[model samples]
Target: MLGAGLAHAATPEAYDPWPGLVQDIFKSRPIHDGSGVIAIEMPYRAEDAAIVPVTLRSKLAPDDGRRMLSITIVIDQNPAPMAARFELGPDANVMEISTRVRVNNYTDVHAVAELSDGQLYVAKTYVKASGGCSAPAARNADEARGRLGQMRYRQFKRPGAAGGAREAQIMIGHPNNSGLQMDQITQLYIPAFFVNELRLWQDDSLLLAIEGGISLSEDPNIRFTYASNGAKRFRAEAKDTGGHTFRNEWKIDDPGM
Candidate 1:
């Protein structure tokens, strides 16, 4: 009966604790109205229930008026809830980012962008992937054990000749089990484990650092753009909820102007 109850549980309420979660991160009062400063991009229906891509863009000004300094993504019903937080660098032109996250059930995912002026802009979208994290590991537990913290990276050069900005994609292998999941054979709950942080660096300079909780998908994939001089190298280091760290690096060829 207990197993049946777990299998047949109703999806949790959508956007629960969203208001408080936004307020806690912004560290100031809330914006009663978020009309024009925020935009959220996500698919209406995910192609694969396991990997849903999301992007958050902030349209705030960059002067003393309102310069965006941070953004947060939250999936309401995940085990740890808070999905990812990104802190922007001074010259960071990264108003957009793409990442995959896990959805325990049908829920609303929120993107909150914060400006230097201490105001928060908010946007949200609903996703339909349910029980994604709780799904069994794609491979056997024993086979997945030794490869847990592995990381991979791929860099793509631009079309022209002179080196300029470039795009890179990083993927880290981790189960990101939401702890609510149970082993199919053993029927025991898998402990909660997920990626905690991912930092992107170019020539030892920080570009973006992401802090995540249990909402990240198994083997999270992140893609973002960065300014690149000719012959520069990029690196990413990630840490999981279980305190395991993995790192990967890539080099960009001469990018045409």
Candidate 2:
């Protein structure tokens, strides 16, 4: 998360932020050729700035049976550039993911995946989206605050079931108002309120912890992966920029989650 320290690839206004943002964020972890391994799905023109959907899929070959280490999502033009990060477990094998994020302006969204072998693969798409992080409040203050940190989860079959790399989808409820947003009625800037972190676990084992920012869409959604050992126990912990905290846990008898 490089604090929008972007100076596009070109120049002042013409500068594309991808090059600088990527360099700053990855630092020593340089990128290599991602020819056949990674794919990113995003619309050329995003219909909504606040809820732009982005999907990611991987093509891990049969020979590369190692579990994926992690996935990092980056929006190159937001105030805080790094949107979220997903860390996977050893038994994990799937990598299909879909999430919603904000784009302050027309920018590139990058999905970088790290394999167990420590190799990184990247996929990126330029989205024609704008004004997401600073858009006006989608909901009133009371309504947004009441639902902050609330989360929803839905499970899907892992790779073995249907031969696809998908496990579950988690949606978190939060205003994520950048504090730069203005209230329609009051015409005053909404105070900075957003979900800053999400920690997920299965039974006693930690799965992934996503550090988020204003770049995360309101009611952020993520499709993630986890191993179904014996008990399908899941837990999520979320915190907001406003200092409010929330937690939820569920146990599923079925191994699907």
Candidate number achieving the greatest lDDT relative to the actual structure: 2
Candidate 1 Cα misplacement greater than 4 A, ranges: 1-16, 23-28, 32-35, 60-66, 157-165, 229-231, 255-257
Please give, for residues 1-257, the per-residue lDDT of candidate 2 as tens digits: 34455544334566677777767877757676665676788888999988888877776776766656777888887888888877765555545767788888888788888876778778888999888888876777789768777788787665465443447777887888777788787888877777888877777667667777777788878786545555567788888877888889887667643
| Residue 9, candidate 2: C-alpha displacement in angstroms | 18
User: Which runs in model 2 stand beyond 4 Å of their true positions?
Assistant: 1-13, 157-166
**Candidate 2 TM-score over all chains jointly:** 0.84
CA RMSD of each candidate after superposition: 6.7, 6.6
> How many clashes (backbone N, Cα, C below 3 Å) per candidate?
6, 4
lDDT of each: 0.72, 0.75
What are the TM-scores, per candidate, against the unseen true structure? Answer: 0.80, 0.84
